[model samples]
Target: MRLLSTIMLALFLVFSMSGAVLAQEAQTNTTDPIIVGNQDAESLQVVQSYFETMDSNLLAEDVSYFDEQSIQAIEGRDMLTQSPTFMYGDSFTEQQLTPLRYIVTEDVVVVEYTFVGRNTGSYATLPATNQLVSVPTVGIYHVEDGQITGIREYMDSDDLYTQLGYPAYTGVQPVAPFTLPEPNAVDDIVDNPPAFYGQEVTIEGGFGEMVGPNAFTLWDEDFIDIGQEGLLVLAASDGAFDFTPVEETMLRVTGTVYEYDRASLEGTVGYALDEGTFTDYQNFTVLVASEIANMDNVDTLANVDQQPESFYGQTVTLEGHIGDTVGDSAFVLFRDQLVGVGGRVLVIAPDFDPATVENNQVQVTGVVQPVDAPTIVTETGLTLDENLLSDYQDWTALIANEVMSVE
Candidate 1:
């Protein structure tokens, strides 16, 4: 009887120890146990789906959890997103949302979460500062029939701007005037010329063959077929109207669109069109210009020389031949055809390998800055020649973003 009692006690101890180990293992392996609080299960599940959609970077168009009427109503109020709430995935990357608290009633479910992501896109007209933001946000959602009926999100906008390296918002800020008109396609204008009559507009397309000294045929940028419809442009009498007649170059013309009246247009531009030369444009739509300029942003090195101040401190894409190297990280970019006009500009690229661009046509996208030797040396750590530095002072220099061979 003594031996049996001792055996029975040992069995009980073993069983108790085994039961505790099994309980711990089960707890450790449990998957997302429902966080229970003053919350209704049905409403909490609906709210959980809403956040899951955000975590997956799925927009309203891509998901069906949101009510159609709620989305429409929210979009009507939010002009920037055109949605009920801010979509983090639209402007941010690697979004991580942590729900801190959930306050649920019979119909309303409010969730407080922390939002974190890297800002890689422009928002509210502010440039991308590439900063990371971790902001606390609250979203009040109205649920019915396991669907969201309405949503109201609250967050500190000023805090968002501050995190993005911008000044804190006051009541008002200055907005640049939008003076330039939106550009119209040449084909669109040509096909429906009457629709654009008398409207002051801008058209961008190829420098499609020149019709006269002050006149040219403008067609779609890629139009190649013969007899393609073109818009006739009668340039302004102002000397500002000058362009290389290369078909590869694009040009922007801003003027009033009108039915081509040969005699009237001749009187307006102070130049008569040749009868045979402009016969194709008779009674057709034409643009009587106030301005005509290159549409491309600094396509050639020579353009930078002509307007150095305009490009100074601005980023530009320059195409030219890589001239002699200045140092391990610096070289000169110039166009062979533009040598006479001093098309050469100094370029400094720390990450670029010069061998790739040797004797090759290259395109360099970089910021255009004035050649100040002290600043260049300080910023780029390049040891440029003293004589070369003095000679190129106040001239334009490009701190390259990339140097690619254009074969």
Candidate 2:
């Protein structure tokens, strides 16, 4: 999902003055290490040792510590050599990596650290940033069989290039489309859907907004922002799938970004509504899934208030107190759902029927709609509340596919 720029920036030194001075926590290489029934801690130790060894200018010695076919995550299934750690080591006269922290989980060791060094050397034809840099970076190490099988480093490449007084690198790396079962992160797909739409993409995230037994919303990591619900995911049949839909459960889905929303809600419902047209409906972005699976990770809930700042079509789950359900099929959560009062969203859940409890804590998982979230009042011939609808015209709400309680 990220790019080689990340690697290039990471290999750039932090700041080197006199000798390659490095600072790190106590390094431990143990035979019988704490496992906690997993390899996380062990993998972390390997990464720590690898970086510590690098500081000692012993980069070649640690090459054996990686898998023979080690992968660089952003290199598109290429060997780690494509990212070229050896070349990086040879480029700088003095390099130092300061381990900021280590987060171990799911067989991955995330090293949050700082890289510092002055470009007193050269790599290939490129010269260094004479100025010492202190770029913060996070390296993700994937461990398998006690070896680091893959590594992905994240950092702001542009910032590093600017600071170094180097021309921005505009060449695109050789990254082919993902093979089947592999995925492009939802972030990439959402950033520019027109370019990625119609292409097969595998997205993994929180599974909430169960539209039906076979339909739901795929909430990306940025669900709390205005740009929630990456897209609507619909299956063939309500009961024809393999994975179960649980609120906040991680879901990995492979699908094509099919139908574009031409109108708010197609058919007579959206046609009859006097409410102004919603532009996102015409964006030509929706998901028709071919395969769905569970992503073995836990996703946190997206805050309700912030769901509008990013991707609006995202599916998301949020928790907050409910104010009213008096508007028939719709209820309010995360904000004032009551007519004339809008906060986060008004939930439209036709199937959800519970005793109205004012200010009762509840969880709503659903797809984000643009300005005009089509409602039944305009669709199924229910009487419309003109004043109430006008009151919260500018706000957005969730078309709840599933609703539950924090209790």
Candidate 3:
């Protein structure tokens, strides 16, 4: 009986070992090159092909691959009730995808691709310009039961701007030629001013002081103003562009003109010149200012900040306050003006006695010239006038023109 039991035990051990080996072999087979018969591998291929087809459809502006029951969730809220629909026809075109590393784990798939676009139409109210932009985007796709259920995309708007030749200015104006039409040619310029009373003309000027939050004061050597009221302001030449952080100087702007009423006066206010008017032109140039102020002040500061090279030896009025008194001899002044979004304060300093300026509400009058570098740091963190500081002894001193009493 003992011998029979031993033989039975040995047979049992061999069968158990055989089962363990088979299990190991099965695990190894699952990791080998995916076979066409494998359901999971087939599902992965289908998902990848779907993405490729969807990319092609997006380029063609055809919204079909979306599931009939699919919904679009933007920023956590469902934006669509049924399948994704395109309200506007072909808003995005010229889509190219550069495949980056992709990872598929369990039920989640992540794809990284560089999306390059050109001549793309605007998605919503953003105008469709011929600007070429490239953005690196990552998409997270959640898959369940062999079907992709959700997708999310991530990218940065500032990165998109940088790809389109729009770099944030550092508050330093560059040297550029300024060409204004002859006074006699004013009749040929576009002169459709806003309904509000104000003159519309394209003028070339250097950047001036910044006033309120996003507004800057513009000035030209030849341009003159009557009073500080009545103006309709907008940013950009076509009145479509707007920006933030008003302390960054150096821009070229063109817009309409309107009168500013008492109720509209918020920041530092300027008036429109009645004599100058553009008959056939609708744009103007704003070469330099602390920052592009707000759209409301664009009409007032437009054409006031001309190109720096145009005002090489001209005295200009700049507003701001004493920021940093470099020494007893010199201190930097901060001025505000409107340019892009609202307005910002610019820093202006010269080689002079800083003792004269008591507070931050002092104005400075100085010659507008090109500085190889910036000498002043605006309150908004942009540096200006760094180059020509050696010529002036106290790089921080500024000539105060007017001092406003702030309570």
Candidate 4:
């Protein structure tokens, strides 16, 4: 009887331990889908299908995935109504979005993927020629209650531009060759016939005959006049000419050779009529300003108050010291130019450093306006524009947009 009782107790303890183990296993299965193999596979399959549908939409005319409440960082808008992912004038006929990996965390799922699009039309007015531009991107999607509430993407712009064959810069070409003309006189060139038009020519003489903003001529020691004849003027494409802002200095020019009517000359040379005409000239010009000249083009608070309506959308130049940062942006202005008592002009750049540009006297050509206090505060809480964020990833590529030469 005693042996039987001991056997029964041992059996009961074993059964109780087994029951506890089974209950713990069930609890874990309920908590984590991966460990228990319950619903993760089904959930992932649905998510994958959703992504596949999104890829189809990207290729088709439908952009419903970016419906209302969808904030696009690249377009700097909250919805797809204002910012379309498709190129400005192009339509996507085929695309492939291959998921490289999917990392599921506690509350978010990160989808790593490669996107290849066969572009068939002009992208931002640039000919696409049906080229395939493959871009790798990583997207983080916040999943709560089985729905995505937010998304962020990271990618490169240089890869996109290289695939498109667009020039990355809109500024003046900085490097070119120039030699000082011998005999130090502009009169020699005017008196002597130009050997060639659009040919590399060297001129030497004191700066003379100031023309428009950046237009000037040279004169020989004997004061012989060398005008626009045989000279090529390198003008800014944006129509904003930068010069030394000083007078009477000897300089040399090596650029495309061109001829303009003497009567039609606005300054030193007439504008090139075509791409072929301007091809030989240096794309940019350099000014050797030794002193500060009157920068009347820049607007001031006092001036704006006096003529409030005139300052709207007008591109003005300014110089000033750096001030406190508003998020990643900064404000700057000279003490003399500050409005009220110690108020400075606000300069907003997402990734600009006041220390790098402060007191350095940069020539900024942008519109001046009053800061919207509410907007500034609101922007801090909002996510960054995806397109603007992409610009930081690749320094060599220009942001994708319709950029016309301001010249």
Best-performing candidate as measured by lDDT: 1
TM-score of 1: 0.33
Rank candidates by lDDT, best first.
Answer: 1, 2, 4, 3
Clashes per candidate (backbone, < 3 Å): 0, 28, 71, 16
Model 4 shows how many backbone clashes? Answer: 16
**Taking the tens digit of each residue's C-alpha lDDT, what string does model 4 give over 147-255?**
4444444544446667767655333332222232322233334444344443444454445444444444444422221112323343423243445634444344434
TM-scores across all candidates?
0.33, 0.33, 0.26, 0.30
lDDT of 1 by residue, 1-407 (tens): 11222332353335324654356445643433223234456767778876877422222322222211121122322232343235552578878887755655555565667788888877665667789999766555655676655554555565777898888745322222222236777877987888998889988777767776778787775433222368888776733356677764677789988888888877777777789998877845798888877854534577786678888878888766566667677777765330012267888887776554323357789988888877777877877676766766756889898777653
Q: How do the residues 323-383 of candidate 3 rate in per-residue lDDT, one tens digit apiece?
A: 4444333444432221122111222343344343322344446544433234234321434
Candidate 4 TM-score, C-alpha based: 0.30
Please give the range of 10 consecutive residues that has the lowest summed lDDT in model 3: 63-72
**Alpha-carbon lDDT, every model:** 0.63, 0.51, 0.37, 0.39
Q: Quote the positional error of residue 12 for candidate 2 in Å.
A: 20
For model 3, how many clashes? Answer: 71
Off by over 4 Å in 4: 1-46, 55-78, 86-91, 167-407
Error of 2 at 43 (Å): 2.8
- Predicted structure 2: clash tally: 28
lDDT by residue for model 2 over 19-135, one digit each (tens)? 222221123333222222134366666667777664322222223222111221122223334454442545555577877656455455656676777766664356755677777
